[model samples]
Target chain A: MNGNGKKKRIGVFVCHCGVNIAGVVDVERVAKALEGYSGVSFSTHYIYMCSEPGQNMILETIREEKLDSIIVAACSPTLHEKTFQSVIELAGLNPYQVEIANIREQDSWVHSDKEKATLKAIKIVKSMVEKVLQNESLEPIRVGVTRRALVIGAGISGIQSALDIADHGYEVLLVEKNPSIGGHMIQLSETFPTLDCSQCIMTPKMVEASRHPNIRILTYHEVESISGYVGNFKVKIRKKPRFVDPDKCTMCADCEDVCPQIVSDEFNMGLSFRKAIYLPFPQAVPGTYTLDIENCLGLLPIRCGKCKEVCEPDAINYDDQETVFEEEVGAVVVSTGYDLYDLNHLGEFGGEKYEDVINGLEFERILSASGPTGGEVRRPSDGKVPKNVVFIQCCGSRDPENHNPYCSKICCMYTSKHAMLYKHHVPDGNATVFYIDVRTGGKNFEEFYQRTIDEDQVLYVRGKVSKVYKEGDKIIVWGVDTLTGRKIEMEADLVVLAMSMVQTDGVNELLKKLRISSDANGWLSEAHPKLRPVESLNAGFYLAGCAHGPKDIPETVSQASAAVAKVGDLFAQEQLLHEPTVVPVDEDLCSGCGICVTICPYSARELDKEKGVVKVNEVLCEGCGACAAACPSGAAQQRNQTDDQIFSMVRAILRG
Target chain B: MRIRNREKPFGIEKPVTARGQIVIIEDRCKGCGFCIEYCPNDVLRLSDKYNSKGYHPPYVAHEEECVDCGFCQMNCPDFAIFSVEVESGEREPAPAESVKR
Candidate 1:
């Protein structure tokens, strides 16, 4: 737009999108209508505005007609906003000077009436035309970045992220809540389809990560709090006391012999017991005994000094206390992984009451050679080999309103593996699986499931189990075969429930602390589901693994690597350029109400108590317009998003 | 559906013959009966009194028989009960027993 009351020189370019739009909307009529519109100097229609010739057409029109700004009526801006912006920027026009009127997704693709679609397309163009008249040139704000990265949760995803980022020459702090870095992957005996030993594949990575010069592995620790934005996050990690010093204590059995307290071995999924003073597992990362303070008679010397007195290295110190430390990082990758839905909630399955009924992970432990039963397929009720094992699929998944609505992506394959493993352990025995459907989407997964039924003799019943109960030494399962339309009942020695997956516990609180958005299903929400899957809606933070949704091992590793690539890209840049559309408070208009300071999710705004006004951290502000809407005095106005421009556009649309 | 009969996982035996004082934290009890079922001297039983969460917590039934094995304390899933050893002369009598004496 020009000054001194002269009409602005503007141009409009309408696209056919290869009949994706022209099939419904009359592109010729819409272009002709906008050509005659006020302030439009030139207007034309193109077969493909994003194509080479079509882009050249817009560039030629801008120079030939001496146009000030332009509008491209095409598909949704999310698809090609940057493409057209860079094109116009090359033609000596401000990137923000151009507006993309989404006639396809908003008009042509939605409306059926040709006459009405053309009319609506013209109106959409007119609104952008009016909005663009007041557009101002803006430059991206450049900010400094810290070189280090922080990875929360040392699961396979976190481990992979740490390894990838560290390999790329960036320092990483890998934090885990448990004393080990393996996560649930470590507890697993074998993986699906391939049947490769999980420990053999997992431990090498763990050892490599612990030894990585760029990676600092922090096990037995948790993120207490995290502040600051991406490129400079100040993290507070809480380190739980491991009473037994990891360095001095040579993992000997002396303390275990003297310790009298017996506690459930949680690492084995509570299937067996261990001494109060014992290692989490034989191959624990640090390989040190941690005194169970809750189960220990007391933490004082006066109470029970058995372990301390017997300790040859004198590593058992009762004075150990939790310590919180801080670190600085440029980016964060949250791959905390998922937790299995508890089987105890399903009363019909008798999962909690009946000792024979166990969960999938527990069965995994039983099949593991280092497990309590020494890898033998023995039922917990009685240490005997279970001849006929019953595996239930979709136990608490894919049943909306009653249980989890989403399918646990790994269950179908894992159940097939369980049955196959069972048949392998007991050559003479057979395994039966009750399922709604056998989903084998991964590579060789379908063949594996078929092999289980054909070679392994695992029976697959297309059904959902209604109830299960223990009678004598057998677990009776009542179900119906949907394919045969017949009700059936059977008795087996043990029953395994394939429970659903959920975002790990305390993740919601952690998301709130990080100011990261989560989906309705409570999984971490990504910036864009299809395009920006690895990035969080908030800047400098990324999502990976089952943190966003249920995913198998391969998918989790892929996502973790993708997140690492994103962090690497950010680190590759010596400085970052942030969006300059942030709102700045007009000190004269701001009453220092402090609403913007409290309402900002990113904590980008701060109230200046001395000046009785608020200030904005432009680098942190994402221009979400929260404070702009809340401003009573018309302060905190976003650049280029002033009230006058919006009124003009709304008025243009309302003008019949 | 209830099973016909049930049995405890295993029986515990006291290795020492020392007098002990039993301490019970009322609210922490979940009434799993791990302490009662595993107590070597049969020193505990489920009480008629219920905790705030509606589980019938166990109470010391035969305190004099406790031999400071700490089996009940170790077996307690909730850590609601424990026994501390006492010398013959160090034992403190209960209020009712002291009144009777």
Candidate 2:
């Protein structure tokens, strides 16, 4: 089916992959079995088909046998599909003409019997050969790249990724669903190990990012929808109303002074109160105030406009409405970060009922210099400095029966830090940390953890707290120290729980809008666990920071930088070349019933009203074959995964 | 179908023209001394004077021995200090008499 009217010559290469495949499956017999296949003009086995000599042998055989197509029966396509595809391309064949049969993971590794594994390998190879015979020589898809990137979340991760992309000389649109751009880092008193003041380092970067020429900060905005493919993506963002104009506001705090409505401040983790119309924090970037319309008296029915009356700049606009706009970007970096697991179900812990008991972040706010207690480390009940404090680790984490099965990675270290901070402020304070095991794997993290025990004289109890109840004025904690085998009773003034972390709110809706998938726990799924950590399965989309999983600041920053590097590499090319193995529409067979249009998750298929047929957007189709499977007329067929090609492969495999 | 960079591009390599000196913004330093601890070369030490935040900021203890590794800058969560490579002429020569010490 090439230019010449001659029978296509195809070669099948089977790789031993060392003991990986050769240990169980008979590779030699699998190659010999493919020799009788009609399209397989050449068949051979190599020790390592991905090595230099193995590739040379393939190149020599292809040239000698005049083969136009190749079938690589080897490991999973995720591992070697690109390798063999490039090898075929180097041998003057279209890359699409190279088909990969995943015999290692699908056949050999999964099956126990050698005879059956070899037979299954032969069938997979034969199926790939049939699929390759039907493959048309395809040109790489070339589409113009927008040369711009979108970064969601204004946390340290999003900020770092945006700064990296902007430094690479490309435009970046950083969107945050908050009033300010600091994310959760700004709420911390200090970073662990180094003990450097968090705001002293974070604020400058936030200021620099707001002033960056290539970076546009869109605070108080959420991504509404995402469309198009890798090289070019069309995104719609809904910018919520921020009554105070950022440009006109001077951050004078006059609006906050006059506003009578007091609400629980989210920045301080509800450890303090802020006026209904106020800035999130003193060092909030853009230095702008946002009106919490839900709680503000000035919004609903216009009850009180005292702040508007006192404002000299008249920055407050009561007529502000949510505005939606679109942006074209070449890539997207997701760093939406995480939220703490709610401890409402744990009645024994008293986290929900007790006023003195708080989570780690709430404790962080209580120790913050700008917090309500002014860094006093006081009990929330009576605003008095507590003499005794208890810090519990792995609350609702790593407990399969009660809570999340996975360890919230930061709890061990942060709980130690909280105890240390409490000891630092409350010099003579009795601080006890109850933990299952102390996990300190980061650089110098173990040293920081040890210092809390030896240097600070903090007590470490290897146990789980069974119950916490208020007995008179003191809170009594009951638990058994597993190491000492002693049932202990401790009465503490305050208790801090290191709660588990989960995906932030509204992330599921965002995932649906982006068409990206998540794991069983709702964490974003990476393309591969080790090979491709930052990239999602959907091309042009990247993940950074805790959005993927629980990670520390250093790990989050490194991953953010990696995500930007991917975006920069994609932006480096003016036109991106995608794999041409996408779906093609058959106008003659299409029923114009709009089934394919509805079935396509990528929005690639559309019903043409004029032609009475379903049209395919070649660039958008990812070749998932979902539309093909759902198509009643069999018109929505993938390029190489057609019904005839698939039927022949099935028949050939079953007959073998 | 093959195209390569035909002309020289700009800003490819950040010009290391600050002659390998660590600049400490005194006010920003929270006295964590991470720069001193993580510095590969023994170029920095805690200063005797306290900053506005009541923390001892770090200072260049051995300027001549510095190699501009930037470990101090990277490790400093406070963004209090950073290393910059400067032009050779812009840097002052160490005293010839004290060079032996």
Candidate 3:
């Protein structure tokens, strides 16, 4: 099998994997069959091929028999390819000198007939042996890692991740889109289950993050672009103009008082009014005031300089322009959180058009102690407490036809919390909740939902609110209770729609910048659903909070901590040794067609204009084989999974 | 199911001779009480004194009973509190550790 016409010395090791593979495939028979193969100088079967003794047997045979190539017939290559690769490398053989044949997940588990299974294992082993005969040595690419982390979004998840990374003595740049550091968590009244005040727990972390020497806060900024590989990421951030000096503007209301222009306060969900110059919230991390350039008359040619004149610190600057800056970091944590589904599109709900009908976030603002009503449950239609409050769950969720089919994980529990908070505000008030199903899948979440029904005396109806229309002074909700098989009509002063959670804005643009894939619904896809849940397929990037999926505060915090730990593990090392499983382009064979450059998702390929060929950035190549498949010429080829190796296996499989 | 009480039983402060000291990194403690919850011998409690960040850091309430297991340090997310072991037989003044904060 050697190219020099000398017989190749090869070894084959079969694994029992206890009963997983041994139960179906006859391991000794397969070993005996492979021992007679043309180039196999040594063959053996072990109880566990990945075990220390099993690996030792292969290493000993390699040294004793002078074996140049090795084939392992075990579980899928994904399960133990790296383990076997390291074993071969330790035995002074090239890592690429080894090949794995799928005998368990591909053969034994799929076939019931013992005869066919054993026969199939032999063919798979023969294919790998042929492939291993042509294997060449490969060395891993090492790159230096910057021990700094950039966390996008200053929500609870991002705040937690940034703080955790900073605690590990790594510098962190926490960037937020809004004028303030706190994200949606700052607007929440009280979290579910424990009922701990969200701001009470959140603001302390925000303040600590602001004061921490290792952490830097970047409010009112967005990630413009991201480039480079895992250990060295170059990020461009766009700093939106605040029109006020962040350092000089104290949390004083002087400018706010003097400003003649008034605008809807976004932090209050547009239910409250604030001057053109205002802070996002009272407990904002930086404690700085931002002037709304769009609404401020002073910024226009009208020459209204009232706010500038009254500013004690002279913070007002109408000429403030947006600035873009670049940063270099080793890793990034995306905790972009989530935005509520627009209930205005759901015409049946009569939300946004009607004053009394509101979304969950607006209700959260109403329940907040620092809100416009001062924690009072006052209806927006009239500044009076509503006696009858109704909540509808799954408004735009789990509806495949017109809305998102996936469950908005937090709606059920939060709706229950909303109902409970309503009852707490008005003891005599009647609280009713209409839900498709109650999904409380978190620690103490179910108990919290039950407490609202049992202890708080909130009525739970298992039904979908078909229609909510304003009739006279009350919003009439019509639906049918499925459990009782009867139609029910309820009149309510206030209606709260638990809107479905959607991915944060500018996700597609951010995804393009980060060079990562997202699911159809726009949630960031993890590397693996189970093993690598916190990490993205692209190295150095991590996902946290609702950005990955819908999750509660505790889960979000835990995930953020997990992401920080991952970043810390990466930062602990001086440099990263990337897998050598990248495709290399044979420049002579490449046509300079630029097909590979366009096909590569990682942007690892480029057409060399001078040479009239294509070049591959080995460090950036992810070895997805997309370019290899798209190449008209067989120039673009992966190192381990080359066209020849794959074709050899395919031919062997199809031989019989 | 009812609303589960999030807090564990608050430990009582008992007088003890000092065997070890748990240094409370004041600003780092978010008062999560993970250390108190994981302490095998119940040697720590949320301090009455507040840090600049307003979080009650975990303090050595029963220093004599402490075995220096380091479970508190291992479980702390913020790495705010860590146990510093002293000589097994070392005897120190009583109640001085309480007022040190």
Candidate 4:
């Protein structure tokens, strides 16, 4: 309320988050130094500014002193920026007038010397104080939402989110690149710990997703591009050529029975074969077959309409081209999931050269009820039950040099599951496992590992397998016995390498388009490691399952539900608030150079030919500052952090 | 010096019972002091004097009465130390009567 024009009174509060700051610096000394700074109506120090007492003190001070502007020095703004902003707002202060100085992470946590840390904290406070003195009142920008969500990838995580969102009475568009929605889960035979059948638990969810009234399952499609921010995104989907009419197709297998070509079946982990036009599995969500255009006989147009003549429904349409459709969605959940690490990278293990060696996923399929040999534990090379089976743990995981340096977190349990399955299938067969460490820390997970050892009589060796080579029909494994200080060797009929889990290839591109950051391991970076594990740096975008990191079934499903809760909260609002400090274009300095257009990750900019100017779409801009830095003419300026503001701040820092 | 002789076996000469002197090369030592720390006789010590690299290398300050023990050479990380057990009777040839007897 600026009814009467007067100088605005501001208060600055600096906090030492316990020893997180005060252990290395003198907090009271720094606060005393800034007591008489200009425009600082009040200055104080607190132990923990984010606690209940600390927040109440701030609100009380703001009300009692009638302070206009607020400045805080605490931990990283990522931790408690919103808490203080809300506290000040409750005290009748504008939220936009708050500025934070990150003294804990930037100053105290990294420095050892007390004097240097204290001096750094003072400088940071001074800079933030300068910025707050020049601050002006701003209004929050509101955009209407479409109240619809788009879920990418039809894996278990995506399916769970779609189901949960649709159950909440909202529309969901679930898109999958494959013809079916089961993803890698459908390929697995059994889950770990409980030894439950994978299909027994997964097929029901697939059927529910297909029949849900609020869900639209779009298979054989991909998201081509995304524009606008959360609550107002315009998404374009590219539907690849299926050559079959989905609306008219019935649950008939005539087309697959008459197809002339056969290809390797990916659903079986490439252990079996499938026709050119066939369903991924009998339990595919859509319960229909998809024609592989690359290998379909009709695509060649030589002489293959045998299925059309025999079909009563006439669902085959050979002339259907690719179609592109656009939809407006309010929020997006990225659950693209993960891919298995390739073991061929470790050439010393004779990975690809040995026919008897396979990955854990392939072994899972072999143990599945609907597997190639009808759940028979047989060696692929000779078609005989293996006398001895050896499972090698940590093939690509935890090796800093050539593979992922993080523990996969699922291999230990899955390997134990594999041993139990082997014992169940072949009673006389011997099972052995070589591992560096067994990390079975989940609920009843240690008991599961113990059951395999004590009840099933599976041998556990404590060491890493150094070398593996093929010797005729057997694979010779060489390793060291660290407990006994002896080198040991064993010959086995089959070996399974427990591979690691890694992010999909297109994740980086998707993250860039969505304006989210990822950690060093390529997992989408969470807001905080412990506090907010399900949310990303970008609002309205939540992470689920292996897209964030490797996790087993229980952990993955819990996180998926957590993501659903977040999206539901976002959809409950009538309008969404976007940061007002986005980049803006200056029409007077028009040069339509188009450099900034190409640099924007969100495609939020366009050049207007009629006026010879660059225009920015306010809804699409995410304020990443990439385009502003690329603007050579200095025509593009970001709100609140304009070029003038940043330049002045830097100059004042250098002056000190 | 006193000496005791024993009967020889085949072409071997008579055995003599005499304490041996110990010598240490300071340049090759790494200051691990396995000998000084584990010596049964407490005869060896690490010298205060340092070498080119300024490390306090071990030395045998009293070499005359050493009962040669070879424990230092076994535990050095760099394999830089070794012991030479020289017979005390080598300085002067055994008396002719003792050798013949």
Off by over 4 Å in 2: A1-4, A14-40, A73-78, A101-131, A650-656, B1-101
User: Cα lDDT for residue A537, model 2?
Assistant: 90
- Across A199-288, the per-residue lDDT of candidate 2 in tens digits comes to 988998899899899999999999999988897899999999998899999888777765544445678675555556889888888789
Question: What tens-digit string does per-residue lDDT give for candidate 4 at A298-318?
Answer: 343133454566667888777
CA lDDT scores, all candidates in order: 0.83, 0.83, 0.83, 0.78
List runs of model 3 lying over 4 Å from the truth: A1-7, A16-30, A36-38, A111-120, A298-303, A589-591, A629-637, A640-656, B1-101
RMSD of each: 8.1, 20.6, 21.2, 27.2
Model 4 error, position A315 (Å):
1.8
Q: In model 4, which runs have C-alpha deviations exceeding 4 angstroms?
A: A1-6, A12-67, A70-84, A100-130, A505-512, A589-604, A620-635, A642-656, B1-101
lDDT of 4 at A192: 77
Best by DockQ: 1
Error of 3 at A639 (Å): 2.8
Once model 3 is optimally superposed onto the true structure by TM-score, how far is the C-alpha of residue A545 displaced, in angstroms?
0.9
List A-chain TM-scores for all predictions.
Answer: 0.92, 0.93, 0.92, 0.88
lDDT of 3 at A514: 81
Q: After superposition, how far is residue A200 of candidate 1 from its true place, in Å?
A: 1.9
Over 4 Å off, model 1: A1-9, A16-41, A106-130, A300-302, A651-656, B1-101
- lDDT-superior candidate, 1 or 3: 1
Tell me the tens digit of each residue's lDDT in model 1 across A1-656. 54346567889999999988999999999899998687888888989999999999888888889987899999998899899988888899988888899999999889899999998898999999988887777898887899999999888999999999999999999998887788888889889889998888998998999889999988888898888877878899999988888888899978876554444567777666555677888888867788877666565423556688889999989899999999999999998998888776798997578877888888888899878788888887777899888999997789887988888889999999999999999999879999998889999999999999999999999998899987777788999999999998998898988888888889889889888989877899999889899999888899888889999899999999999999988999988888788999999899999998988867899999899999899988988889998888888888878777788888988883
- Which pairs in model 2 have colliding backbones? B17-B85, B17-B86, B17-B87, B18-B85, B18-B86, B19-B85, B19-B86
